[model samples]
Target: MYLYKFNDPEKALDCFTAFISRFPESGNITLVYYLAYEAAGKAGKASQAETLKDELIRKFPDSDYAKGLQDPEYFKKVDSDLRTVDRMYAEAYELYQNVYYKEALARCEDILQQFPGSKMSSYVLFLRAMCIVNLQPADEARIALNEVLAAQPTKRIQTVVNGILASMDVGDKPVLYADAEMYDARYLKSVRNWTFDEEKHAENTEEDRENPYKVNKEEEYCVVILLPEDMKTMQVLHLQTRLTFLNAALKAEQKDEKGDYQVKKEDLWYKTTALQIEPFANYGEAAVYLNRVAVDKTLLKNFKGARYRIFAISKTNFSVLKRLKNAEQYVDFFVTNYFDDRGQGEIITGRQGAAAHLFKYEADEKHDFVLMVPYRQVNVKKMAELLHGIEPAFALEKETYDDRYEMVVVKNVGTQVQSMEYLQLVSRNKEIFDRLSGTSSYMFTITQSNLGILLENQNIEEYMKFFDDNYQRNQSGEVGVGDGDFVYAKSVAHKFVLFYPNTIDPFKLKTTFEEFNFAGLMVNNVKYDDEHDCMVVSGFRNKEEAMRYFQTAVDNRKLFRSLRNVDYRNFIISDSNFDTMCEKKEIEQYLQFFKKYYLE
Candidate 1:
């Protein structure tokens, strides 16, 4: 049971089997078999599952365990119904059992607020009423007890509530109290246990995929409010609530993408010992937010506690404190590192050298470029479609124009003279270029070196100046009429079994696939055909299984309209290795990779 609870079901099954072997005659042996059956199923042992089922049904026929097994989805329903609140209530009950009434009260209040829809809420309230009666005034405790009664608790709970009310009415003396101080960190378990996984988050962010080691020593600042020590739980929660309301009001003034989302809502909140609000553009922005919170008239009413010092912290040191899971440590790291008695924007900036690669690029070698006629655009597919008929050169080559754009380039246009003549030909026929580039484009006699420089600096003025100084009039370029949209594509190689016959309705094909389970394919592939007029089904599957798929089409002629196996004239490859190799009008690498990996 211990092993299974912690996700080692196989070992748990082994332990259960061992126990049954050693103690065959134990009267409570059916309980072991019941748990063993569950572990066997979880471990995916089909034969072992059948054996356990037979043992329960044949030997323990009269037991409740056998009767429960009659329902096929019994264990799945059991696992789904056990909510996290059930475990939280147990933890709170344990604290109460240990005579920590104040801690119990805080835990109960947290559970009630955080899980309003929880089935155990009324029970948690009853526990809270018991705690408040000991510490708070009679009126306050009475109000809480009455609220619990209003919730219409269980009969057993109602009896406890009535007893507590009777005792409070008679004005009874308090229970035993612990006078010594407990550990500070334990008291602030909410904040002390939570760690911000900054490194993990950095890895997951979109920009990190390109040169992930690149780090910034200075940017991404946050606001930190030093919460008052020796504060009550209610006071801490109230402050957090007021701050949340303030943030909501600030955000409400801003515009967002207009849509209403139907989502399964979770109140992803935790009681904080110290509050840290984040993601300001810079320290200046963070200062504005912090200052407003301190003096705002609407906020002053709710924030009746001692004045807490609010300040900005750098992403570097603030991450360290959160990583350490000690909010007080933020003060120590701040003083040691970026914090001065100066303004919030005054962060010391010498540490960039240590993490230099994290902030800047490393192009430590000299390089040169080969001249080419590449025209970049936002709609490269539209460019290809519009220009494929006019002249093959206009649509002959399309490939990556760095990370943000793809381009239709001139292939096999060798020397500076050849690139110039080609550029001039397209430049003179301005309408052909204009029609090809839909909106926003860079049509230039660009080099690989020039493109690299553009990617690194992203300064168009500098690049244009450089181009004008180096290239002649024949190498001149033009911008498109409309704004050229920047288009980016990420290509992945998938081995799809495609059949483009003179037809098939996608809906009928999809319905047939739903009715029957096909082997050697993932569900995303099985659910639909790739496109109309073709059946492109599955990727990275066995040829024999794909061959067997033709039989399905043959069996259901209504779904597949005259579909048959035929060799496709063209195959696609996405790797740059294939791209460069094919650039010289060669396709040997593509033939080897495409034929080898395309179908099988």
Candidate 2:
């Protein structure tokens, strides 16, 4: 009974078969035959199932089992259908294991079409829902799971569905909070033009002049704003007003690309005019100017709780964007116009080692020419489409760019621009160049460990791919605790813990762990022991129960290859050391298990 309840029907079937063989003439022999029949059916032994059914009916015709087996032909058909469904399910599962999601989904759909109201309906429905989850977006998958839920599935199926739901919500909300104090160093230099280098042009040959699509230059300023979702109408007005004021203040001193003098300065923003500062050349200077500008406390107060990173775009880059229709043209115009001394402006002076903590801007490196402006009109995929050889890396928060921009570092900027002869001006220091390029790279806000991987790989595509894959894996598990929050001192005693070996792929380990988590076998919490460079899983009630489950997993070979070394480490927590492993949070549901089952 325990083995069957634990989902090991094959082992339970063996036990039942042995029991019936020894007690053939016992008073409860008919019951034994019936039990064996059920066990055989569950274990997918159609021949054994039919034989047991026949034995129960022939030996004890007056018994309830015999009465239930009255319709032999109907029973045979039921057995045949059950075997067919099991074979189809196994094929579908195999497809899923190979990552052939489309094929797996097709197989599941076929089962639904062929066996609409069979006994395997609930399990089939669950399988279909899981296939949809793997095949579609989270929202679509959620809808499918809800349909399964509507069918009122078995407790096991319900638990699995609920677990999937719980996993979908992990890290869906914003975690990085921002307010007025979070402005970066480059917010004030939005109006300035990029400093063109005469020396860079002096070094350029005739080839550079003729083929102009290549550039290894940086933008002067990029201001990013991290905004909260659903900005109020007044907040939008205030932001517009601030931008208008800043531009108005710079019009008198700054020259247009045509070298036309600006219109006379108007006192449109009287508060900012009092500083008597000209258009900002440096970000630090602009920061100082903004601090001095006497804007209304009420108007400034509006941005206190709001999240926004306003990019202080350079006049040159801003002009380029305004003139260009798409990224392809944007790239073409920059390469043709600014490739030589004819259009190159003056080199920036004195600014070095300046950094923006709130946004992503480095003063010393050459900036990436590609910009993902906050405007909704700037479509990332369109740009990627126009520039075929190019690919995007990571997208910022949906609120940051209004779901319009993706931050991409060009690894290999295609030289073929609009059928023109173009040269490739690749940056030598891509990392430093990107930093100084004034593009925002902090949108993902990855962890230190992930940061290490990015630095090691240095391929933005690889980094973003790993990030996305990790995010999906994190969203498929019951225990959705942040890995960074793992505390050794806070671990509880007598709790079940899977002490893993030090050597293991962290990503693979996490994925395998999620697969093992189910209804009764819940993962209450997780902890990453950084000092030992391993994972500690503690949440189950006692050592004995935890060990029993662990042994069963080993016997069933339900572990990843990396975890197959059963002697690598202990799988259960000792009573003396369990609670002392870490402290417990009062809010965690796992603590209740300790209080309920162990405290008394």
Candidate 3:
């Protein structure tokens, strides 16, 4: 289960198989059977899964677990039935109030069996304790009441449950801190287990635990560059980049001969307000810095209309205002909290965050790339036939600019590497050059957003200029050649930085290391990650891909070879094992999973 939760299905199934053998009569055996079947399917053991499904049906014909195999709505129906427990609990509550303890107990047990984790679960447990307290033995009542407390009921339910537990604690010490210890255990306890500890649980809300602000206005101040929500995405980014550059300049200007900055460079950080440049020790210090930035020839003058805004706020009040995200509310908070209504000594107080230095891309949202072919050069039918020859998923699209062009797009081209592989296919086939000499262009690396710009402008050369500029920048080792010209989100996909003969020289790497990507790998990019800094190739779709890349590049040393003096175009190192990328990591104990109930 742990392995499954961590997304390693093969290991999870192995553990499940072992558990089945060791504890054949485990109480959770029925649930375990279904879970193992699920793990098998996820791990791509389709034959094994089909066998497990049959075994599950034959062994437990009447179980909901078996019914679920055919009926997709089985769990939804179970949930719908459980929803009636609210009114059922009301009837049970009436019986308990009228001193019908036996009847109430029956209803509570029925609800417990039918609806295990319902919203009114805590309330039902509380009623169960109440019914048993008067009718059953002291020990029975104590056990029942402890169960109620463990459910972590509402404050009203908690007060009654805590009172009952206090009466039963045989500890001779006067229970002065009973509420503190028992009532808030749910919040404090990190791990789930049967054993309870007094020190771990204490009654506290989430807000009380998380708040990291205190009110103090006269001591601290900060310069905030607000990124108003309405600003265009590029404008905000440009402002942030400019502000960052100005900060570096300030550090250089203030540093002593010994290379120590006088203003403490550590104070520079980007928090929620876009960028908090320098947190100052006094109000006058912030004022001086802001004034310097506003008037300085190189700092603020370059950015058009670089006027900044400031406000007076104490530390604690600032957190509330920031959370509210309302300028009017902050004004009101300043009026209500500070003594002088003029609002002079205000500061934002919350300080429980690490500095954000880099912007990143998450694969949750994808920026897809496509190839645009001018219609004057090639028609959709010809393009379609050509793309189909390369990869069947590659197809021609003719939506944006019908008169002048059609685009070549592949279904879910996994990475930039896979995109390049299409071009590689065309490059390898020399007949394509003569076959379509009319082909005006093939994009080097262009995203869907770039396609929109090309379509709207209807000027291919104008759009190609951006790529031309970027290529020159890439060759010249420019940090941000494509920044102003291209519109892309700051976030980039993640790649592993570990396990490397870390070097930044892309030139040292031999050709055709990616001769292997022709296999089922279909990676997005195989370019140098942080070319100015590291020796890692950035981007892999998942852990398995990462492992495969590692095995080829690091373990097998296929990625790097001594810089040789000959034959670069004949980049092949020979026939390769595709099992590295597409092959499933199989279960070591593959047969044991089927030992008990499955057929070969």
What's model 1's overall lDDT? Answer: 0.49
| True-vs-predicted CA distance for residue 284, candidate 3, Å | 44
Ranking by lDDT: 1, 3, 2
Candidate 3 runs further than 4 Å off: 1-32, 35-51, 57-64, 70-72, 86-126, 131-600
User: lDDT tens digits, residues 370-463, model 3?
Assistant: 4566765666567556657776754445455566556655544444444444444554444444444445545444445555555664545434
The residue-by-residue lDDT of candidate 1 on 1-600, one tens digit each, is: 234326777987886788679877654366667667877888898789779888988998876467567765644443343345655766676566444678878888888887774556777888888778666777888899999999987666687788878976798744534433222323344233222235435655754244212123357666666554344433444455456446545664557621111111111112233566766766566656656665553333233333334456667755454444544344434434444543221112111111111122213322222212234434556655544544554325665544555556554443555555555455445455445433444555555455555556444444443343344423333211211121011122232223343344334443344234333342121111223232334443233344355445446655443243433222333323323433443434445544543343
Error of 1 at 255 (Å): 15
Candidate 1 global TM-score: 0.20
Off by over 4 Å in 2: 1-116, 119-496, 500-505, 516-530, 533-545, 555-568, 574-577, 582-600
Query: Residue 57's C-alpha lDDT in candidate 2?
Result: 82
| 2 against 3, candidate with superior lDDT | 3
Residue 485 of model 3: what lDDT? 22
Write candidate 2's Cα lDDT for 1-600 as tens digits: 423335666776776677688867654466557667877888899999999888888889876457657854654565567667767976776555434456767888898899887656766677777767755667778888998888777665688788878877783411221222112211222112111234335555443455323232343333222233334423543443344334334443556521111112111110111112233454453433333222323323344433222222344554454333233233344334543532111110001101111122222322223323334434555443433333244222222322433443332222223111111111222232233233333222243333334444343443333333333223322111122222211112334455554555544554445445432342332443442223344445544556566566656555657777543433444333334444542223333433333333
Q: What TM-score would every model get versus the actual structure? A: 0.20, 0.21, 0.21
Collision pairs in model 1: 214-358, 215-358, 378-485, 439-483, 439-484, 440-483, 440-484
lDDT minimum window of 10 residues, candidate 3: 350-359
